[model samples]
Target: MNNLASQEQIIATAILIVIYMAVVLWLVIRGARKTTNIGEYALGTIGFSPVAVGLALAASMTSAATFIINPGFIALYGFSGFLSFGIVMPIAIYFSLIVITKGFRKYGSSVKALTMAQWIGKMFNSQRYAIFFAFLSLLLITFIVLICVGITQVLSNALNADPFWVLLAVVVFVFGYMMFGGANSLVYTNAIQASIMLVVAIVLLSSGLEYFEGGVDGFIAKLASIDPALVKPTNPDSLLFRDYFEIIFCQLVIGVAIVCQPHIMTKSLLLKKDEDVNKYLVVSIIALTFFFLVVFVGLYVRVYFPDLKVGGQVLPMDSLVSAYVVSKFSVYVSLIVIIGLISAGLSTLEGLIQSISSTITADLLDPLLGKELKLDIDSNQILTNKIVIVLLAAISFGLSYQQLVSPNLSVGIFAQNGVYAYFSAAFVPVIFGTFLKKTSLKAVSIASVTAIVVHFSVYYGKFMPYMKEEVNNPAIAATMAILISVVVGGIIHQLEFSKANNKEALNVH
Candidate 1:
């Protein structure tokens, strides 16, 4: 694979990346000028068009997992991976996004909520609940690690450099800019990144048109020739997509819950006007639909490397997309794809850094140190946020290096485990808080705790049959956790409601 990228190609890619970084830094500086207080830093002071925020949402939602990592799953597991990731998950995500965005934004903007923890805490009127979620937001670091590993793979392959150095460079550069840029810079940078990704998605999807020259059946037959299971909707031999339960049910449940994450759900609050909400949803969903389909490129790469080998060495799933870009495209084309891939990772990385660091500073530290200790936390919060980003960068680099060096199948697994648990715990609280007129704080709190416990117990303890395997599906554990939490929370809410009604009736009599 190293031989596939010429010396000229490497130099061209390196130069393009440098110019790309410069453009991003310029955007950050422009945005930072508007970011004076923690509020502006978190939500941005500038008014952005619905279309731009929509693009930012699309870019953040479709991270490197869409462009770089998940394709590796499709490459390995075949049609089953497409069914689960490409088809099932997107359907659930878009539906959930549309359903939740309106109500969330209405409440978020009204209260001037800055982070998920702040929203949840205000919703429940419980400072402890907010602090709990603040701690849980730390789980998002796993997702940051994922984006770092993905960008590292693309950059390392494009420049023919050591992945360790690439990973280190990616973390420092992206996290450094995010320390000051916050949401102000993130939206503009993400909109630009999303535009590049849109073109690159089309380029990548159409790159293997020759495979479809004989139509859909011919493409299936080509894959079947490689392995009959490649054409099947369910790959029993695979670790993640073994049956309808894993492919359809689990992914469907996880998809709806996935939008509960802070970076995704809070995007609506960026829109200032009620009229903008509908347009934001429409544009983002349409763009994300196309971006999600980019995973189909994995099948093309599968056909390219039938045995999943290049230059007599087996290609790791994470490197499959990078290898394909360099080997299959011209130098110029490869550089475009490389930049798009980096954008995919950076767009999401910026969001995570902004949202998570804000959670630490505003939701976690300010509450604990300021209110609790009567300190002037707000006076130096922006500086504290920058320090939080630095700490996050260090943690992300360490975890990302581990994934790059020794992954269990792919970094996707490690990420899904932590991310799934988070949104799983968040699902009931977010859903009930958004739609229900009245909710029991105790009930929602119990539900959240149940989700965390159930998710890890099923995942680590191997309680479910799906978990009995050597490599478990985080979706399965997450789905079970979600189901149980919903049931528990529902029961508790009803019981409390009935008891309160009885008390009111007695008082009236």
Candidate 2:
């Protein structure tokens, strides 16, 4: 594979990444000095501004999933798929701003919530529920790390570089910043990254429109020419409209899992004031609206590069919509695209690694295994977090190498499916419990556990049978699992409330 980029483009991309790395590192280092305890490091000593929090939240929520996979879908499913999934983002922003702001502020700093599981446990008064939720949270973070690694590898391939080295470089850069800055630094960096992403996405879309023969309409015609189904709202040959609708609903609910995500919620605890939440909401929503255009670029790419192949799958690189421009445009423009996408990936992974490390240290190890290790919770937790970051980076680095050696063996399905299953079970019950004061801890616990177990069982079982030549989209399976969790969690929560009320009445009599 040719490097296919000019020296000027390469130098510019390198300079941009270096500047980004330095800025993020400086922020983290500044924050690190203020972190005296586990709470401060993991949750930010004082609250961050809502603008910062919101931007970080949006960036973390998008991740390589948006950068890489969404484009892949656009290549195959066409613009309709982009619209279907893309629509939920605005809804997510609205919920965060209108529905969630007041609730989050009222909850405030008292909770010291580092993970979504902790938030759920606090709301429901059940550590068992927290533990189950933590497991799911763990799975989600794992998938994120896997995706980060996957995208870095893909980027490396596109650059004609060694995939392992790219993974190693990214892991170290992210881990270093995250370990130094903690939550506060992560949010600050994310805000900057979000800005870069918005600018870059806009530039790519504009340039692409100018360069393409048909613009969006012309591109659509090309797609329809190849396969008429490309323009259809849904492809009956592949996915049904009912399935697509269900997928939309499921993704929307799963989107709530973002509210409960450890990395994103940690920003809530870091809020400098309640007002910051408002600012963060506005900034995040506005930025995300622009970023959504990135998906449109993917759809645009499908029109021209209909025959490109990735991983034995005949698919266009929808995820790298900007990269298509690189093949056509001057090196400087392509450099901008690379810089933006790389920033998106790096800033996101930085938050993810730190958040996961904090979870392992604070939520998992210190609580469960610290005493046996003969160390106090606070000091030991810090040490453990650092160690976990290094180990995680190494593991990710090794995995990237393995992926390059045997691309087929390195399919990212396991991580994605596992996360979907975990979040569906973990977040649905907790969010529902938050609004229902009467929702019992016991019911929450049962529902939470059942969601985890049932999701895993069906996921690995006959529900999405592996025996099929063309497997059902993991997105569809995930949506089904989330729906089941919502139904079951709601029922269990109601049942527990009724039983508790009856018991109280009998005791009073």
Candidate 3:
């Protein structure tokens, strides 16, 4: 668990990283040329293959959480973490992704929407609601903070650099490049990142093949040897995996709602044609399944670092995977793995910057201040988008530095709180908008507001049974919000329909 890399290893990794960044910058510059305005930047005008966008979706959806931080959870909690993260969560997410993508994409393409906030506004004929959600897109800054922290951890471990400098460098470089490329550069970079990630995922998943010396039972036995609870489906002493409610139910609800994010849901809109969607989905699902299973590497790392100490320092959960990688692999192999890890963060960071900046420029700032500012939003939107990215980078750097210095448990919790609240509020709108033909703005907006209230209440007020303790789970709060929102939204929609029917009948009579 040594955190320090050798001088040779550091130099080799630094050189390789420079070469990779050069190639990526070239792609960004090329894509930036085609991106003249916000529409083209938001959704690429250049025709891309479904397979590529599909891979990009997989890459963006599976962020640093999947590759780096979440593994730390598994390393600490064992089988229960695996069950929630690897099994139940994936089942719920994949099911939700398959269900929503088709309809969301179909509707999104028809509306010609640029952002998720725009999609919700257009669907319900409510610009005010769009503004609310656009401001809420600020919640995604927490996620940006998560990815920045994660990449900082990986790069810091590889080069034995200070986390502060690494964090600043990461934000400047990723967000700086992202200002120009938007979706066009993002998809190409993501596709390439996804390809490397697929290979890395396979390598990491198979790294512990020798652990399967006997069979499935043998793996369990080894885990049991370390700690009996490590093999259990639910670890009683753990913070998050205490019961079925937390492990299965909470994950199920969050999984269903997780795809409502602008970066993920709008990924399907990148494809120019409908016929390409099936192939896009097919490739993405397969690739993402592979990405999700890579969480198993967490369990492997836990076994690798049984004591969870590096240089006699108790390794923080966020730093465990990076320390393991730096210590486990040789210089050459670790160099490649380091690139894959950085790719994991950059791929998603790029998407979030693109989507959220567009949301700020188009959905929030444009509608609110365009006329007053006398900005020709349609003609010179790209400049506004660049401004948005700069603001995001500054805010993210400040928040991420804070989290890096003092975290609640991990930056993962900080991210989940903000990100979960967002998708929770968004779930009802996206669900009702995509599935129901007859729905009112009043119904959806009320439900959305209710979700926002409930999510915060459950988390901060400690209303849920689980939230009464320290290190409370954000999933519980988000799940409750999504559940309540759906019920409220459905009832309101039905009431609105019934009232309309009565009015029509009375008029006809």
Candidate 4:
């Protein structure tokens, strides 16, 4: 209810934040020296170790959603949210990550593909498809907005400052440095961020050990005392997790396909050699598993505020974790967590800004304006990418400010809508290209189109109205999109195979 941070806490926080920024900026400028071209900027010229890249990968994949927003969901809806967010989703994602990363990196490095749109285009041999996806990648701006709001919430609460000023300062600082550092600085910074996250995750998870005085049984009893639904696998009153279908099936589908996003899948391309893949996957999966399970911290927060009230105001889900951190911890502990929280945000925010800007400059603008503008890929393109980042920062700031002012249920929904759709379209091309041979680009293309259509149609149309309210869940749309893409892509792949077989047989005759 009160501004829990003391004057001393605020001063220490500001000092620590400034020191962190200075370190980051120094590292970034050092990396920027080698980035004479767009290629070097996006892919990084640095010969990074697998462990460093692994930590970076973990940081990129988790984002503010895992550390900040989803925990709020668990705090609100109870065990159903935890079962889905903390348990089932991680299993599905880890399995998918291991299965997909090696093949993707191998092919990506072989072709020297620097971004996801470029990879898809190269794999399908369709420049048009690549350009289309480059434009589609703009949808990731929603995710950037989500991170901006999440970080601002934490910083504003900790500093007891106005959210608007915090939001402005965060955007300028993050996006400004990102334009110079690119991927080279990003991996190093992300590794540091991941290390901090690993520590804070342990602290947050352990903070509630006292509540577990009765052990696992006792913890559940505490939740049950407040609301019996809090202990159940499904919370009927909740919007997202109403049944087995929504909780397990939809979450599993989303987890498996979620990595198809550019910032996530392209992380493996940072590693240099083939032999390092196993080590990278091992470290990343292990670290990310802990990060994912940290959503259970929501349970502790819920127990701390059983009524979910502060000063008689029902806390919004986006701000709940920020509120809880300030109220629960002493100044010293809270300062550490605040830095870690900022890291959680910056790691992914950096990835999004870099990948999206590079995709626009390299994949979209280069193709559209290169010949007409008489531009070269070496120096001119790098300048274009910076310009792109500037535009991206402006757009992100506006959207983020809007969400912070009047959110439609939370910025997470606004993000999931756009982010989910982009990845759903990508799943077919990436999956088929990596594993299956003799795949038809036509088939993959059509399947992608189908996926995007099906996803939006399901969400907007409210296709199935069973045990349900309005179709506000993004996972449901994404799940349906993935299933149909796989099924449709398989059918098309078979058709193309037979057609080729017939043509080859005729040629032999």
Itemize residue pairs with steric clashes in candidate 1: none
Q: Write the per-residue lDDT of candidate 3 for residues 1-509, one digit (tens) a residue.
A: 24479998899999998999899999999999988788989998888999999999999999899999999999989989988998898888888988999999989999999999999999988899999999999999999999999999999999989889989988988889998888888889999999999988887888888889889998888888888888898998888899988899999889889999999999999888889989998999899899999888888887788888866788888988888888888898888888888989899999999999999999988899988755575556888888889989999999999988888889999999999999999998998998988899988999999998999999999996788888789999899899999999999999999999999999999
Residue range 254-327, candidate 1, lDDT tens digits: 99999999999888888989999999989899999889999999999999999999878999999999999998
For all predicted structures, in order, the TM-scores are 0.98, 0.88, 0.98, 0.98
Please report the candidate that would top lDDT against the real structure: 1
Report how far residue 308 has shifted in candidate 1, in Å: 0.6
Report the Cα lDDT for candidate 1: 0.92
Off by over 4 Å in 4: 466-471
Report, for every candidate in turn, its global Cα lDDT versus the true structure: 0.92, 0.62, 0.90, 0.90
Candidate 1 stretches greater than 4 Å from native: 1-3, 371-379
lDDT of 4 by residue, 247-334 (tens): 9999999988998999989889988888999999999998998899889999999999899888878887898888888889998899
Candidate 3, position 170, lDDT: 89
